[model samples]
Target chain A: MLFHVLLLITFIIVILIYEWKHYQGRDRYVFVMLFALASIYLLAAIVDWRIPEYVQGVDFLLSPLKKPLQAWLDQFQI
Target chain B: MEQKISSIQFTVLVFMNTLGTAIIFIPTIATRYGRENGWITVIFATLLGMVFILWLTTLIGQEDDTNFFKIMDNRVGKLISYCLILLMVSFIFFTTFANIWSIAQFVSLQILMGTPPQVLALISTFTGLIAVRYGLEVIVRSAEIFFPFTMLSLTLLALLVWPEAQLIRVQPVMQLNQAATFVGVLPVIALTYMELIVMLVVLPHVNDLRQAKKAFLIGGGLAGFCIIIVTFAAIAVLGVDGTVRHAYSIYVLGQNIQIAEFFERIEVLVAFIWFITIFFKVSTCFYFLSIALQHMLKVKNYHSLTVPLGMILLATAMTNLPNIFYDFEMMNSTYLILSYITGLTVATVLSLAMLIRKYKEKVK
Candidate 1:
């Protein structure tokens, strides 16, 4: 876990240096915020947070529709 | 100087986009739903898809040298255009993640066993980042160069597998399930033609509008034909049961090839075609997502965001898709619905908006 975290930080640092050299003002700030959010998300995933479960929740809610849709679609079968 | 791609290059892009991941999954989906009559679903979808392309090109041609986002801004107001743009960006984001996750799953299962999916996802996303960093012309040129080899390999796969194909496997042609066969058209259309809606983001960069439209139809037709041949080959060679059994049916079909028993197990070579096509698809989606972000944030350089966006993509793919079964479930249910809502529905609304604006202009 530490290795992964360090890897993520290193990637962000390299990208930040490149951005700092090439971009300024709003672009750099936006890129920083975006990169930070993405890094947090990756960190969350590495730690086995409930982040993925929320996505699976979508499937759980939509599961009811699948059977009916399948049945309806199966009606087209000769 | 502005970068421009030729119509031929545009056609290759379209071809690559339409084939995308559909090349890997279409045979199984078609045979599963349509049974032995899967090829019929492809043909029907292709015809409908052509009409769709016609409407799309006409809508695009009505404008000058502007992309779909700009067209939306002109026809509709800023508020609605931004909403539409957000929807497109979301669609592109999910699609890109799906592609990355797919390649990761494939590599993990087939080639590099026991490798973590996140690592595989990182590799795929990083490649996409490099491609998007270079911009569209470089991406299109790469596709143009790879198109012939991809096609040649596909043709060879079809021809080499033909001797093993039996007519009896696909026997009761069109007689089994008419309703099911017609319904099967949805997934194929959703995966191939509907997904081509992303091309609207890059259409304005083509050198000639008239030729771009022609290339659009030809590219779509060629992709449809390749899909048909593959579906037929899988069914006739593997039988309907065999085709639907494997997740990557095309790879299994490639494994069936043998030249005097010495030249066998060439599934890796067959898998290479998919790798090339899916890379273009992932890169195109990433590129579209970046452009959409640049327009939305009013950024001076889209290049600056590629690395960050690619990171987000990698993270999202790893988080959302936990396993191959989850990926399959999402593709069949959520992803299918999302493609229709974002892709076809958006295209239809934009076409209507274009017509209304044109009619209002004529009155003025």
Candidate 2:
């Protein structure tokens, strides 16, 4: 988790520098934020603590959606 | 605003784009009709893409220096053209969403069980957004770098799986009905190749469009070869029941192999290889989406639209997907048909009507 956080910090700093350099009028800032977001997300994923909770949440959200949609397509069964 | 990609780069890009996730689904798709004709379905479907390559490239070539949006302006009138352009953007958005989230499902299931699908989707979207920011030039270059490694890993796996391959698995070759084979190929035809229509934007910019066409054919051939060999290997080892049940049959095959007892459970290496494919795939879609957004919105810089567009795709993936099983059902049943039929023929005629008008305008 610390490694992910450190990587995220490093990427955020890099993005800040790249954005500052955006004064020169290149599009480097887009890529910079991209990496930064990627790093933060990776960090969160590594540190994900609520898997059981998230799993249940997903089931709650999806069950209503999945079953009927499947039923709607029963006629098209192949 | 960017320069055209060379034929070789386009070659690798198309290959990386076409080769993903198609391998695993072949048996599933084929089983619906017949097993013997699985390879035949790939052939027929690939031929449809190949034909589209000829006609779509030629149609765009007539507009010399034209891209999809410009062609749309001439081919279709402004209002309808704008609507179609929006549809194209949404199409790319939805397809990218499915692909992005599926990668998550795969990682969670095959590599890191219980890893949140959102985690993979988020990482992949961010990585894709970065690639989108770089534009096509960097994407083409990165594809070159990853191309060799993807080939090497796939080859090594195919080689390893050869030992356990049973010749009997492919026997009873005529088990599938000849009449149903052509119909069986529809999903592949529609999904894999129909998406090539999206390449209409990238077509005119290809250096030596003929060579680009050739590269498309070659890349497709390479994919088909990989499909046949891998399918054959799967059948040889797992037979129909085992192959059908196995989600990551190739990865399963990889794990099942001994390779001097040192190479057991090496599917993670392959999971990484697929990571590379997903990288190129998402980037390609994101890049195209950016360009299309620029054209549609008349933005001077595509980079500005990248974040919002990525957000939209993320939303599309998040909305209504519900779970991995639905995602697979969508990909296998709905998406393939949509991409093949709706993507190829329906979209083609719509665009072609626009192309014809453009050609007449140029002629006049």
* Interface RMSD for all numbered candidates: 3.1, 8.7
TM-score for the A-chain in each candidate structure: 0.65, 0.42
Which portion of correct inter-chain contacts appears in model 1? 0.51
Q: Model 1, A1-78: lDDT tens per residue?
A: 888778877877886786787888998888878878777877787776766443465456556776676567556532
Off by over 4 Å in 2: A1-78, B62-66, B177-180, B345-347, B350-364
- Candidate 1, B225-245: lDDT as tens digits: 999999999999999899888
lDDT of 2 by residue, B1-364 (tens): 6468898888788877776656555655553444555556566767766776666555554566446677667666777778767656655666687778778777888878888776778788889998878878788899999999989888877787788887777676766466556665655654566666666666667778778778777776676666666666766777766765666666777776777877777766567667887788788888778887677756567776676566556544544477766655765454543454435543666657856867899999
Q: Candidate 2, clashing residue pairs?
A: B75-B354, B166-B236, B190-B339, B190-B340, B191-B340
Q: Which ten residues in a row have the lowest lDDT in candidate 1 chain B?
A: B59-68
Q: What is the lDDT of residue B30 in candidate 2?
A: 53
